[model samples]
Target: MTRSATARTRILNCTLTLSIILHAPLALAKTPVATGTGGAVATISEQASRSALAILDKGGNAIDAAVAAAATLGVTDPFSCGIGGGGFMVIYLAKDKRVITIDHRETAPAAFTPATFLENGKEIDFDTAVASGAAVGVPGTVRGWHEALERYGTMNFKQVLAPAIDVANQGFTVTDIFSRLTRENERKFQQFGTTSALYLRDGKALPAGTMLRNPGMAKAYREIAARGQRAFYTGPMARAIVDAVNRPPVAGGAGVRAGKMTLADLANYEARIRQPVASTYRGYALYGMPLPSSGGVTVAEALNILEGYDLKAMPRADAEHLYLEASRLAFADRNAYLADPEYVDAPVAGLLSKAFAAQRRTAIDPKRAAASVAAGDPYAYQEDQSIPLRPQARPLQKENAHTTHFTVSDKDGNVVSYTFTIESWGGSGIVVPGYGFLLNNEMTDFDFSGPRPNVPEAGKRPRSSMAPTIALKDGKPAFTIGSPGGSTIITTVLQTIVNHVDFGMPMDAAINAPRLSERNGAATSVEPGFAGSAQARALEAFGHTWEATPEEIGAANALVFNPDGTVTAVSEGRRHGVGSALVQRKGH
Candidate 1:
């Protein structure tokens, strides 16, 4: 290895040695909560959970188990994620004693720009764009998997992919959620030849509990297992992906508006290693993803703003009001300034600074919610304030509620918090023929109508709300948590942490608790339980406008490292469907 790589490895070796001496926590299974001594995995699927546990049982590290679980998810949770998409991965290296992030978020093609989503000098209809290949971004999951394995895993591609291939070939039982989503996008799915044949029969969703198989995904995995990432980026599969985008199916008796992807764009695709965004709150150090994902910065800033208050000592209703306000202020700043760091300037350190949070906290009126809120200036908190703060503007967009999050921990104390998506369910409504994968419509995440920072540009990643996070107590990970809920992801993660850390709720209880999301908008959205609660009534006394929604906010998967050395893994009990959490070896 090179000098820098060797140095990093030396630190890694030190941590590995220390981890070897530490006893691992085991866990329970097929349910939302698992506790034991050894290791654990929690996600949206039983197949995914089992795949990781099996890896841990066979002596794989957190990275290996995570990739195995992710591949299995691609097969089973195909609509939510697959090899056609990209995501952010946050990992705590038990050996290195530090956190690292991989920014594999999909990028805009080299020829893309602000006008790509516009038609005749006007922005195109969102639904029309979503269903066309114009929304597709370069597939990044395969390359992302390669990067994760090469950097930290002990197993080969073949070893980790074996389970996923089996699932795809043998099939898994369909559930209500899967059937419902298919029916929701039935018309759009019918438009594409490959997508239609793969997801529907006789213009209807496959019946729930039916064994659904996708030999195409199995073949795709086998090719990657044999040839590596090149199989997707530069080999035969690459041509297939390029064709699916540049020559999308006709819509409304005409060619689609914007599809400019080229083979070179796919060939040049690469995942990056980004420094983790770090901050502190309540005597604990928090580490999250850097730019490209606003979740880390926004969540940390919200917590920092809330730090000025003694939440634990206050009445629960009063404390919740403060949480909503902090979130409002943080989102104003996020919407105003955050975007792809590669294409625009962002006040990274300034956004996370305690001084900035302190200044922003002054806007909170403890007794009432603000009638209106504006973005705060964080540039002053940084030594270099050259990047001027941009004006605030709200992007017109559709809310996507189908992203997925998973958490895994190994016997060596290594932890993984991964969140990925295909943008919307059944992404782009087109599947590459013979590939058995859906392409990502992630580019539509760009602000289609603004001179804003998040406006689409060549090779720039869209700003994301996906936050995969790890909290450290005294320099060791106390717990790792993340959720999937589109824009609500930030608030979901923030409130869950506040619930557990400040209000003293158990991890499982914390996840199941009602969630509220305030984005400096006219109304704050609340779950059914929260909308009618005493707390919601109390918040209304503070002039908070409530928009009660029947839909669940987020499906979160989390793992808590206990003082007794046993680990507790938790998943959402009711959102979407019943999730699965498993431990390698549960205490007797």
Candidate 2:
């Protein structure tokens, strides 16, 4: 048989196996427990959740399920993430009682320099910058998957990737949101022939319910499945990726010059496994992704400040005010000190110190907001003396990054919270000729105009707000939660944790509660539910200006472990996510 015929037959057989594995009932299923019971998966896509659950039902561990779910998301929710992106994963291995953080963040190519984004000493247009090869970073997602599967997963790389490969080969029904996003970025997609050919049809975006098949992406997946990470990072796939990125744009296309990426950059890439940053909030131990990600330090700093207040005793409005204030102070530090540790000396030890939070807390006025908040001297708190601080740069405009997050807990008590992104929707607008996947525009994540801590540097990963977090109580896993919304991600995660720990809300309620964000010096942005309510007025009374935005805070997904050892899973309903629990009742 021809190669195409063989692949088709294999996909058909896999589909049949998946149908039975996902839908058929087990003969000896465990007894049903309450909501917080059994293995569960929650994510932005329903199909992704089902894929994870199916893996768990087949005896795969949390790491296995997470990989399966993430892979599926790449195919089903291509705009958010794919093999072309990078991310962080926080995993709790129940057997070892250890927390591991994997930083698979994309990095600048070896050819990058401070002036890469500048021409004639002026920053290039944002649109032109993003639609070019210069914006593409050395992808780390494919390598990350292989690393996680080989080290911590119970299953092999091919096993975890099969579900996504099947989906890519057989095609899936597109959702309304997918169709809308495609239409919105139609002109951008049309700028690159490969992208236009893959995502658009007849010079237009595909409509909802279109059975989208990505055979090229399927082929890419198959290569990885057979040859492992080397397939993408060192072999034919790497060459295709480099060629696509380094190719000059066609005439009339909206893009900048080709980048300076090299094969060595791809071959030398490695996903670092680092220790998670840990802090205590109201007796619960919180763990967040460390440097290269500002989420953990920022969230921990805010939680430390909130710890000083008796939030449970305050009225709802006062509670909201305190939360917002704490978030503001935390963000101040984030803007000043957070960057890739390899490139900048991020004072991680001082940033999360409770003493530093205590010192910074003094800046907050219970009844009114500060005229302008500044980054605190965390080193002073650590050394018991003031140290010289750098002049703070103006905060960059909020990034409209598109990302995906998912949480999975297996029956063995292992859990994984993962967040991945391609930097923006339809990243770089340049697809590898035969790969059918978008390349991450992660280079734009840097401070482009001037020399700052996060300026483009060769081999340095961009600073990210993608924090995949886990909370522990009494040295045991309590909750796994995370979200996707650029800088709003830090505040979104802060609110969810507060809702659950202080307000005594269930996992679902905490995830779905109204959200607010105050990053840098911008006006506080509140969701419609809180915009015109008494809470907004109360915040206004505290000298806080506010703006109303549609309820597009963050897509937070969480898995909560109850005191009784039950597990509750919830996905932010606002973003059309779904939650599934792999529980077996007596009848089944």
Candidate 3:
């Protein structure tokens, strides 16, 4: 057969297999809320959810299911996450009753410096910086997956990777979001020969409903499945990745300078197991990702401030004002203190301290928003006074909207809340030749030209807004929650927890509730559902400016553990993603 004929046949066969797998009677039985005596999985992709459920059905634990689901997402939702990205995972181990956090965030190359993005004493153009090799960070997703599997998962890498490999090889139907994103990023993708070959066909973006096959991605997965983490970080794939990042920009393009990442950077990458930042609110313990990710500290600080108010007794308007007020304060601290702990002292202990939060809370006026909030002296509350406290510099905040989040839990009570990203949609818009994946532009998360703690530094992980969290009640996992919305991630997670604990809503309702986000900025953005409501009017009355943005507040997914041992899983349903709970088959 001709090469084109073979390609067509493969695509056809893959489509048939996908149809059978997705529409089979057993698969059809899976619902958004699957009540199984065994386990449940909630994620942003249907294929990913199914893959996770299959792992559960095969007697794999929650970690196994999460790894399986995350890998499948790399294949099905490549625009948001892939092996080339990095993330954080919060895992609850049932047997040991322990919660562990894995920090696989991408790091700046060894050659990076504070002035990497500055040219002639001015910051380079943001668009040019985003599309250039300088934006590429040493990817940590593959190492993170390996660490999770080795430490917590029961299945081997090969077993968990098979589903993703099959998905990439067989092909999947593209959704409207995918098609739209491709069109929006067509220029960036076309700037590179390799990216254009993968994302575009005949100089045109693929339309929705088309079968998108990525045999090259399948091969990459296969290699990893066979050789383990070394395949990606120390072998042929590593060389290919470095080569692509260092490749010259397309002729006449306004791309930034070539990357200086070395193969040593890839080989030295390790996913650290960090202590989760913990706090208590309304008798529940909230655990979130630590430094490098400002999520936990910020959430904890906000909740601590809110704990002073009787939210249920207060008028809804007053509660809304207080919520936004606390968010502003927490974000103020986040901007000042949060960064890669390896490069800066993040003052985690001071930031999450209830006493400090109480002190900060005193500045909030229930009747009106503050004119402007500034970072507090949380370090003053700490016993260790040796940590230098520097004057905080306000850095320009960049919006990164593309990322993926998933939650999984097994009947035995193991749970996983994972959020991963490539920094933005299509990432740096550069593809490793024949690798079939986009590399992360996570380096752009750093402050480009500022004296901020998060400014780029060699071997430093970029400050991330990806917050994966788990709430515990009475020392057991109560809920697993997270979202994707750049700076909005902190507020989204805060609101969801509030909706559940304070508003008395179920997991699904809490996730679906209207969201309002303010990141200590000039304007607060509200969803359409809340734009004209009494709450918005009240917030406006409080001297807060409202920006009615069409942007989705968050794409959050969560799993609530019922007292009766049943699990309720929910996907935000903001974007076109599906959620499911898995039940054990009679024969299985």
Candidate 4:
């Protein structure tokens, strides 16, 4: 052959090889970016979404927009989450290829102990620990946002917080979720006069779209604006927390020993920065919040295991085979091993490994189903022993905790995935009057009668299912996604990523589409809207009990950046006016 002809043949071979790599199906999914300019913003509340867009328009980058949106969310969506609580933040910085995980999770009060919730040999009424003065933890949301802004943001604290302050001071309409949740907890709110006055309007829970202004919250923000994060952590705000929790007025102003929090707990609190739990599927990288939050590891592992299956050809709502098989592996690991990484040595690396996933995937039979599945002994694989966790007895009755989520991206290529919760709606239904929000009943996150580590411990963080996630393709961020659900946060987030990345759905479709999740042998919870008649029938045929509500699991949001330089963003439809936004440079 002529030298030129031979060279031409080699070039063609290289081209084919690259094409195969690019087009080949990956183990994990990648989102199809809908916008060509590659910028998008998403959040659970419309007010928050619009706030983020305003910041982006004002020349703030992704970090600024995210912080602004988060602060706005705290105001507009008070029943679900806020600065009064705590949360986790995951950031993808393109310039340095850095994936930062910030753990601003709430901490147990210093004076707390296992015995605090123990009466005789049995646990106290779970409600005793879950409600009232004792449930509140050391809030870290304020500090967490401040940390992110200091490190990556262009705007100062006041600038970033003004939007939220305005909304809280001037009022935004009460959302449907807020109204429903508030009414449900009206009696609890009325238990404390201060709490009632703040959340209730004319002795009734505020109606949806009622213009609700929280001057107290605005005052709190004012303090934050003037004194920075310290206002909330160590200064007057801290004093307010100390006075309120220790001398809570609910039971004639009883103090701690009577089951209340103290000053020391507030003063000593500090937020953490932890290593992200990372896993790869099909060349795309997934990163999420680490322990004290098992959501990240569980979601990462679930995706890793699913990658071993060929899901595209499976029947829609492939309940007997695909859903159950993938769920069996994921939830088993979640139950047997997942926990607060700070206290336990979880073998996350081994759990998500290709070899480990392959071994587990074999349990699935394409034609039938495994009657039951168990957590295969990790000992079978010789997983690293450096990680140590004392396993807890799984819960007998599923407790409920509600969470909130948001995702943001800027033209500068910074991404943020954040999830926060008050454990349940209008947490404890007990508000600290001047604080402008209800406190979280996060103590419920602990198993009432689990092993030593899983029980409530003084100064320890609770286990959480707040899974905030960011996915990267070819070393660039493809999207940021997260959701608000108690146990289902993991599955809702996992499937959304799969829909976008693996099945090639747009961001809106990925988040709004029907989804399903199973936890620790429970009946699978499929989104009422997402389940098809076929899927529902298949589930019933398999003797699975199913509930079909608009969305039984969660409310999710996602932002996908397309290769063609556009962005597509979506929020859960049931979330009620979940908003979408994009900000591009005028001439770009």
Top-lDDT structure, candidate number = 1
Tens digits of lDDT, candidate 1, 1-588: 011211111110000000111134344446888777777677888888777766766778888888888988888888888888888889899898988998888888988888888778787766677777788888778888899999988888888999999999999999998898789778778878788788898878988998999999899999999998988999789888888888875434544544789889999998998889998889999988788999899999999999999999999889999999999888888888889888878887888899999999989999989855878888889999777555764522234556888777777888888888887787787788888998888887787767889888998888888888889999887987788777788888899999999999999999888888887777887777676677778889988887644456778888888898888888878876877877766744
lDDT of 3: 0.76
Candidate order, TM-score descending: 1, 3, 2, 4
Better of 1 and 4 by lDDT: 1
What C-alpha root-mean-square deviation, in Å, does candidate 1 show against the real structure? 7.6
Q: List, residue by residue over 219-298, the lDDT tens digit for candidate 3.
A: 89889989999999988999999998888335345444689999999999989999898889999988888988988889
Error at 225, model 3, angstroms:
0.5
Give the per-residue lDDT of model 2 (tens digit) for 1-588.
111211111110000000001222233322111143455555666567667766777777878888888888888877778888788888888899989989998999999998888888777766677678998899999888888888988888778788888888989988787888788778778888888888889768899989999998888988888888999999889998998889933335554568888999999999999999889999988889898988899999999999999989988778878888899888888888788988787777888888888888888878877654778877765643344556474553455446777766766777788888887777777878888888878887777755567788899898888778889999888887888777777888899899989989887788777788877555776666676677677778888886533445667777777776666666655544333333321111
Q: Decide which is better by TM-score, 1 or 3.
A: 1
Global lDDT scores for all candidate models: 0.80, 0.75, 0.76, 0.65
Model 4, clash count? 19
Per-model TM-score versus the true fold: 0.94, 0.91, 0.92, 0.87
Local lDDT at 477 for model 1: 79
